[model samples]
Target: MNFDAFLHSLTSSFTPVIDSSFNPEDYIHVDLSPSNALLNQVNLSSAEDIELFLENFLRQNQKKVAYGGYLEKRSIYDRSEHFSSGSSVQRRNIHLGMDVWCAANTSVLLPLDGKIHSVRNNKNFGDYGPTIIVEHQENEQTFYTLYGHLSLESLDRLNVGVKVVKGEKLGELGDATVNGNYAPHLHFQLIKDMHNHAGDYPGVCTKAELKFYSSNCPDPNTLLKIY
Candidate 1:
């Protein structure tokens, strides 16, 4: 489906990714930008530091969940080769997905009806560990969604052609060490075109490729509606 039509469908058809306790008031929408003073105050240069930061931040906010980081320029990515290893011209910082920050092992629900398209363990520093991709058909158009940084146990019993009902418990968020060595969270992305990619897609891209990827992967908030 084209971007505009796909967005309309999500509003009507998809369920919340975290359905159990989804009151918007119970969660804080965070901005992980360079100017966020909290990052500097904590010296967030390591995965452990991030985990601690999120913990304290959530406690202070009187919320159990903290979510954001879509299209955000994050410094946390500097810890791994996935973003900074590339040449200066190709350096990637813009996150292409909406992160659902919660405790590890929190269930990740399927937002809509779908079938498994591919699955793999993207086990690199700052990568999607035990990623799962699902293909959905609506209005005679096919699209895909990627769920990243999932627990290793979540991979069990998944098959390429198996159908998953909307609102079903599909997987759990992975721990920091397993989830690309970062704080526990779910990286949820909606894609119009997989671009022949499977089990993996660029969750971040350089400014040079922003125009194309932004269209290919529209703001996940169209489905998430978290703000």
Candidate 2:
């Protein structure tokens, strides 16, 4: 699918990150942009302070910043399922979503103006730490996208059926402990049918379920327009 067209179909503010002008076609194979903070500024001395700042920022601005995905050769092949298992025992089932690496509290945005179809906090290490599922309909097609690993405060005030805008800041990435015990990042994903559930959705899939998962959760770069 044309990622750019799909993105524009969902959002009007997306400007494809391009050199001269925003060209979605030219970005088909472009690398992810550099991390001005995570791999550069975040350090031990600043970890706590940065995390605190992130929390407050989310409280103030209420938006989420994206971080990791398709960075040249650094990305793990989407089909590779043999990732080293984390402490959670769920074998790191090949990252299915682009990780928005950032300090805890970085606000996450709802890419498309949508309604809260579901929301849940799967409280387990290496799990989707405090997640929200937003449902969007475009061209008669109903789809769902998930934002996982969020701050506790993000969910503190939300409930089902809440209205949100395309650029509305929905939540923030949480600290390691509350945000799935990893360097803080938002796990973003797209889903076709939620099957039947609320407050929880699978953020990862095994090889046996790859085909279904892929079809359900389309590439989010389509909406994000980030190369």
Candidate 3:
């Protein structure tokens, strides 16, 4: 069944900022460019300092941290990875969702009232890291949302079939070690069917698979509306 409209109808309610009492909605939508705090500093010199800088910055600013499609779709993939050896254009795919780059303990809220269908630790570098999937119903239509790069402890308090309400704080984003082995960030994606699985879904898509993935994973901005 075509769920585009079902998905579109829910867009009007997504708040760009989680925990807005502490963090403002405007700050969540800002693009802090070239800041070492947001973008990783590339320095051939002092690799140790670079490591320290990422860890320190992540610790301090994981909350209120900002980065998005500053130029074109820079907030998303850079298209630097090789699809093959030498194919064609290095497709710089546009990012459909907003990323909340912050510390491990930053809390994530349930965007809407839903039931916990599945939860698992992806446990791979650059993976969802730790993930949660929720099945939600609005107007008798059922859909899902995937929350990735979450803290390990978040799963400790949850179980399958748990009922979560709108604006309820679900879990915190994990650290670099557990969160896909990169800088800490929340990889949130809204999905329709989830294809009857749990614990994970493709956070990134390839050029060849763009058409299918795009439809399968509709623009999160529809729900986020942060931009």
Q: Order of all candidates by TM-score, from best down to worst?
A: 1, 3, 2
lDDT of 3 by residue, 79-114 (tens): 234212253453534343456765568788877889
TM-score of each: 0.93, 0.66, 0.72
Query: Whose TM-score is greatest here?
Result: 1
RMSD of 3: 5.4
Model 1 misplacement above 4 A: 12-14
Of 1 and 3, the candidate ahead on lDDT is 1
Worst 10 residues of 2 by lDDT: 70-79
Q: Pick the candidate with the highest lDDT.
A: 1
Give the alpha-carbon lDDT of every model: 0.84, 0.60, 0.63
Worst 10 residues of 3 by lDDT: 70-79
Say which prediction, candidate 1 or candidate 2, comes out ahead on TM-score: 1
Once model 3 is optimally superposed onto the true structure by TM-score, how far is the C-alpha of residue 225 displaced, in angstroms?
2.3
- Candidate 3 lDDT at 149 equals 77
Candidate 1 per-residue lDDT, tens place, 1-227, comes to: 55766676666633478746667677788878898987887655677778888888889989988888778887777767778745877788889988888888899998889999999999988899889999999777788999999999888869898999888999899997788887889999989899899999999988888888888888887776666
